[model samples]
Target: MIPLARRAAIGAVLVGSIAAGVLPAGAAQARPLTPATDREVTFTVDGTVTYGTLHLPVHRRGQRMPAVLLLPGSGSTDRNGDQPPALTPHTLAKLADALARDGVASLRFDKYGSGRTGLGAYADKPETIDYPAFVRQADAAYRLLARQPEVDRRAVRLIGHSEGALTALMVAVAAEPRTAGVGLLQPLAERFLDVLARQLHEQLAAAVAAGQMSPEEQRAIGRAVDRAVADLRAHRPIDTSAMPAALAALFQGLGGPSRRYVESIDAVDPASVARRLPPRTPALLTCGTIDPQVPCDTTTPLATALARAHTAGPGRVVLPGVGHDLTDPADPDVLAPAALDALHRFMRCGAPAAR
Candidate 1:
């Protein structure tokens, strides 16, 4: 299992009446490309120059085309779903390629600490970066996508992976002109801290089973984590002085530059957010059986929430052998065909239903 600290760092819905099913092996082929152009774009958010790429289908002219705003997942991930110096899955970029081929436009940007949009005004005071700041950036991106002359404002959709999924939900719930739908890919079905706590517990348990940590040591760390979680949730300062070295380092990192951001995200209940989605809001929830970060079983609450809300689209799809990045486990460099198929179907069928 990946370490707690490392795993902690990395962390959409859509429309229509498509049925959920798994694509057969080798079914990852895409339709022939429509000529498209990629342009570098920039937008301002809270005085920061946010950088992004806008993908437009060239063949479709004189008609507004469907569009999507791709939100990157947690930790230093960039506009193209890559974390430099190591990870380079290119999930979002591939999705943009697929969407353009399908005659759909897309916009993906570098958020705060990543890519060309690095830090910006927050260079001196990184602590000022919080969940709301990310939301504002995404909202700005969505607005830019909607305003583009080539996009149909009413046909714009939001697709986010992992932590970005929460941001997408918040934006979709409050979007003006009413967002057409959302695609929540590899989403968190619970509060941020709750998910963190559960992950820590599982890690600790595994450590004990492996004999790397004694049962007593595991219990001690678990207790410390519980206290720290309570402090974060209550908006109180975390006192990590008494924690084990590993636990202390983890909590200190969370409580330092990103404390406010961590707390803000912790306070959000994803299920509750799902409940607030506008009536008939189309949603597509997906999880991968091979995704260790957000295992398929943990998605129940989010699926349940969407069900109660009466949202449209193919509900909660569980993909086989796919990972959190929506790539096949064996080939992390390429996007999974089944995942792509789901997204294409959603975008194709997500036109706003007649009132």
Candidate 2:
């Protein structure tokens, strides 16, 4: 389950300080978040109608404002960073509202399997969906934002979290002249399978450390993962009958679109893409030091590559004690201040008041 959830930020069991029975020090009940004006918007990609919410800041007419396209992480996560059975902290919605307050407009959409899209063109057949489709959706959204009367065509930026980070990069690198920059939060920086295998190894090793899994069991799990990867690489069906329940879920996902998507992206190295980005294309690479899905060590090197390309803004930010969800590592309910500050700074890059 952990492996599958980490694959696309889907189905991963939710954990936090409350779940761990260790609340944050002095943590208090959170106040109700203020609602902002969110307009229902739709766009067509490959003839498939996609749905989303456009967040707008208060502004007078004729004011051409900067805008951002928000891409949520993997799985069936809606525009709010939630996949039912797992309630997120409304991470993407919060970010949208935050951007609005900072005088920037934002658009956040529900991908195929989530929200109003309802699988779109992949309703009956899941195998047709892959990484390129995500990139196309993001590209269409960016174009829509740029054409809005209230938006500055040259100031359209993209913000992607988790797997969406790769989609954002794809859009940025393939964007029209209007693309301003990109912000990657908790990006997957390695080959898709390598990252998944490493995560599985870590989980198994941790279980062994806690006396829950024996050395033999751990080795067996490693061998199983290797075989599954080999099969996926060959475009063959994965055999999960012999796997543990948690791991079986991961491979069972390989029977559908997840399999095709994973296979398509497993070979696309994110750092290699970053290194080739146009020098003037600014980027913000952020990672939480404690993000279980994406290790800070992995993001650090991607940041270094972007910096070498002269596309990084300031430097990589590893927020202390934050989670893959961009909230308190211990208490998922609490938003991390450092992450918010860094995002704010990155969104406002190159302005007179840029941090």
Candidate 3:
């Protein structure tokens, strides 16, 4: 599931110190360090105009460059991998620049409810939007990227972060033009609700042990959460009357306008999706050891699935002391060099001989 502002709220309720930090101005709004030409592009999906920034490498005469479709994580994250005012890592934008330096083109887009896309046709009916809606939007973007005259249609890849990684798997599984490769960074590895449940249980348990929440209260909240999950999976209404205020609000967020999306994503086990990838697909999976949202261990099953399917590339590269954004925790401005290096190697674009 996409990280949302509500996650901080829930964290505060369950664990007071789990607050999100705001990046300094320099880090939040820094221009791309590497030079690349950027084109603002738009495509229609479900009558919604999707806005994106296509970063193209300097043209080499008679050369059709490899390309990638960059997918941002969940929540209100924009095409640049920023959830404005609080989180502004600009992960995808920097990634595009990196790809440009490697003689590869990349397209990063704003999905519905994000950036310039802003709900569009679903402005008043956001509830109608679900997981498939995002998949459709991404599929359209992939098709658009592949059709670019300067792009090598056969060399187009998909690279996604967090929730976007799961979307990439789904899109690659059914790509029409066929995907050259896939890169998953801090991916969602389990069923969405299962991960949510485990997180809530751990936090609630810790709160009880810390004397922040009573054991009785923890039991009550757990029951309420279980009930809500059941209702969501069964396609019934969630009843939050028995839940505490904070828990109630969180469930309401999960079950209201985003309910359909929650249910749809929850139905998918990412490892299962990985198993369906076409045999021998080039794939790269990476996880940060200190990433609280997606623990490295949780990605083991996904890595195993990909390996069993005979997918190629470095199966899983574990970066120590890195956070969910693939950055050093102490310095959010710079993405971890190891992560970037792994990506560069996977794309196989930076070498002069390759160009």
**What's the lDDT for all of these models?**
0.84, 0.80, 0.86
**lDDT per residue as tens, model 1, 1-355:** 1123543434211221121235554332332334678889999989999999999876534457888999998889999988987988898998888888777889999999999999998989999888889999999999999888878787889999998898999998888657888889998777888888999999999989999989998888888899999998787889786677887898889988999789888889888898888878888888998888899888898988888888888778888888888986667666788897788667756585311
Where model 1 places Cα greater than 4 Å from the true spot, the runs are 1-34, 352-355
lDDT of 2 by residue, 1-355 (tens): 0122364443223343344367655332232333446789999897689999988887654566788999988778899888876676688988887788788889999887898887888887778888888888888888888778777766789889898888888788767754678889888877788888899889889999999989999999888888888889998888775579979887877756677788888868888887777776768888887788998887766887898778847557888888888886556665688888988878767643210
**Reference-based TM-score, model 3:** 0.86
Query: Which scores greater on TM-score, model 2 or model 3?
Result: 3
Q: For model 1, what is the error of residue 164's alpha carbon versus the real structure, in angstroms, after optimal superposition?
A: 0.5
Model 3 agreement with the true structure over 246-337: per-residue lDDT tens digits: 88899889988899899998999999999999887889999998887899889999999999878888678888888888875667777788
Provide the lDDT at 268 for model 3. Answer: 90
1 versus 3: better lDDT goes to: 3
Q: Would you give me the overall lDDT of model 3?
A: 0.86
Error of 3 at 238 (Å): 1.5
